[model samples]
Target: MAAERRHAQMNSYSDIELFSLATQFQPANYIELLSTSSVSTLVGCGQLCNQNVKCRTFDYDSYSFMCRLFEGAVETGSLVPSGSSTSLVGAVRFQPNLFAAFGQDCVQCTNSRYLICSSSNNNTCQCPENTIWNGVKCKNQGYEDANCSNNQWCRQDVEYRCNNMTIIKTDLPGNDLMWNTTANFSMCCSWCGNHSDCKAFTWISSPGMSFGMCYLKWSRGGGGTINPGYISAYY
Candidate 1:
């Protein structure tokens, strides 16, 4: 069930099938999607999409607890009308606000203060363990500082990010500004974050990639691509 259970994800900054999650959600028009722990609440769905650089819009059903993500920047007015259930709702990319009808609130805990509702305790308002929503996205508590409880100097800039299941092919392939090798994604992240010349980093963990490989680039290389087990992020 690797393919089926492969979709199962633990909400975090990195960790997702960034590529294939699309094919899985396409035909799921109105049918009840097979239950997955990855997306339980509408907020979790939004969070999943938020972590992806390609996700431009998202659909959520409060009643069915289903989330559909789209890569196109679409307007809600032109979205596919929910079949028979009035519980479905869609929102623009990066915009959390929505107008629902014949339905219920997508999240019970949505405000400037609380962005996540504990799945263990639905009524409870709190963020995932060790993460804090940094206005635009949820980031490691002390990712860009030296004052972390562990005192880990993860990064010196708050501009750092981790994009799971993503890839970045540096434009300067022949230049020393780019390189690839077998290594841990976090190690690559840490290296790139600390390297003055590094601007983006990518990692892939799969059989085809010899378990995992880190790809580092010194400059931007356009948008991300769908690569299974690939994790790409820029600062």
Candidate 2:
């Protein structure tokens, strides 16, 4: 029975020492968390590393035995004990090291945008539909740049050649990017074209980057380089 039984995670806090239970079946992203429960439950934020398969490390309340599913796995010093007052229990909270967990132990991901190295094969990224794979990451619309910054924008025809492709917005700070939506690169370009202060743009597919949404930015402050294919038109 021990050999076949799957492991599940649970947490314990006593006299300032914490103990984590082992688990098998991992979660994609802490999908269904009932944070308001009487007990506190937490999961790691990244996938399991060095293990045979995906699993999560979790911590539950003193008397409970439920594994909290993080986006992935737990790191050595990642988990933290919730404060006595705050309810780490029923309220859902994301792990702080979520992204780092995905990039753990990676030696060659310094310049790669979304390429995560795993023990069992490398990670797969969700790229743009019109784009193709380029060994490391995804490129849009037949682009072939080493860092995904080459000819990112192309001639959408003469009168309206895409201007300043592959731009980033800083007007609203962090409000420019969205994840997990059904918008396409063309639509994203159009949106940038219509905005008054939009000086440049960068667009990536959803799911892998930021869910399924596009990130739009307005840069009143200049001094940034532009991609080669754009027509130098201002929005």
Candidate 3:
């Protein structure tokens, strides 16, 4: 029977192997893709923490999938082909110290009823009273946008919304403070990524000024204190 064949396949791999297969089936499910022009090299390890994957996280740098196979699950003589222009490279092997117990059948392992999700922080999702970690899994709360930004807007001292939805964050001149004149959204993000003081920011595509200005601000909603600050514009 079809059901029996599926059951047999499920029993063959340990929980970790099953999780790896799940991740392969949906690589983009929970990842924060920072791609420009449909391609990027900088991949985050945190992606696995957000997905149904139990194996070690990997980074894909445009050309290759840099896999961090869980200590022992990765074997010697494992072929990781690297392509050149179009030609493919061969296999190289290295033994990892992890064990088969580390290999898993579910992305999450249920201890009685508590589910262990990731190696990071030993992040666990507990089953509610009578509920258990059955087939459905727990997801992030708060940020509900297509991108999980947690719905909380980056409000400046003045609440300035561009086109009435994109909130504008303002910056004051001081130590560790950063603000820059940028032409568009991309430049604004670049400015924020380079600045340490910038936790989140916003920019007006069209402002009174000739070009737009990047507003560096605090990340209070994710859990931080708001301080008295100044905004150059009125909300």
* lDDT for each candidate structure: 0.42, 0.32, 0.30
| Inter-residue clash pairs, candidate 1 | 165-230, 166-230
The TM-score, computed over Cα atoms with residue i paired to residue i, of candidate 2 is 0.21
Q: Using lDDT, give the best candidate's number.
A: 1
Instruction: Pick the winner on TM-score between candidates 1 and 3.
Output: 1
After superposition, the stretches of candidate 2 with alpha carbons farther than 4 Å from their true spots are 1-161, 164-182, 207-211, 220-235
Question: Residue by residue across 114-221, what tens digits does model 3's lDDT show?
Answer: 234344434443422211232343222211111222223211122222222233234333332456765444445545655656656644433233345556655523
Error of 1 at 134 (Å): 37
Question: Model 3 clash pairs?
Answer: 14-104, 14-105, 15-104, 15-105, 15-106, 16-103, 16-104, 16-105, 72-98, 143-150
Rank order (by lDDT, best first): 1, 2, 3
Clashes of each: 2, 29, 10
Candidate topping TM-score? 1
> Which of 1 and 3 is the better model by lDDT?
1
**TM-scores, in order shown?**
0.26, 0.21, 0.22
